[model samples]
Target: MNHAVEPIELARDCEAIAIPGGETVTLPKGTAAFLTQSLGGS
Candidate 1:
């Protein structure tokens, strides 16, 4: 699989799952993130 390397910033708080535990968590606003992957239909 090929992963993206784009950089991005959150404009608002986002909800995402935590790895390892798969727990639901809120990602606070202004969080910096990297574009990791885009699956078949995602």
Candidate 2:
């Protein structure tokens, strides 16, 4: 399955975890993130 990779800019500090694998990632405020996929239409 091919998924779209998108570049997302973070507005504030947020915490995220990797799916399929349990990995914690901390995103600081005013940062960017490369999102591969989302859940619940997120």
**Can you list the residue pairs that collide in candidate 1?**
none
State model 2's lDDT. 0.73
After superposition, which runs of candidate 2 have C-alpha atoms over 4 Å from their true positions?
1-6, 18-21, 38-42
Give per-residue CA lDDT, model 1, range 1-42, as digits (tens).
465577689899988887779999998888987655546972
Task: State which candidate has the highest TM-score.
Answer: 1
Which ten residues in a row are the worst by lDDT in model 2?
33-42
Clashes of 2: 0
lDDT of each: 0.77, 0.73
TM-score of each: 0.65, 0.46
Looking at model 1, which ten-residue stretch has the lowest summed lDDT? 33-42
Model 1 has a clash total of 0
Best by lDDT: 1
Model 1, TM vs. native: 0.65
The digit string of per-residue lDDT tens for model 2 on 1-42 reads 334477678888888886769699888987867756445643
Residue 19 lDDT, candidate 1, scale 0-100: 71
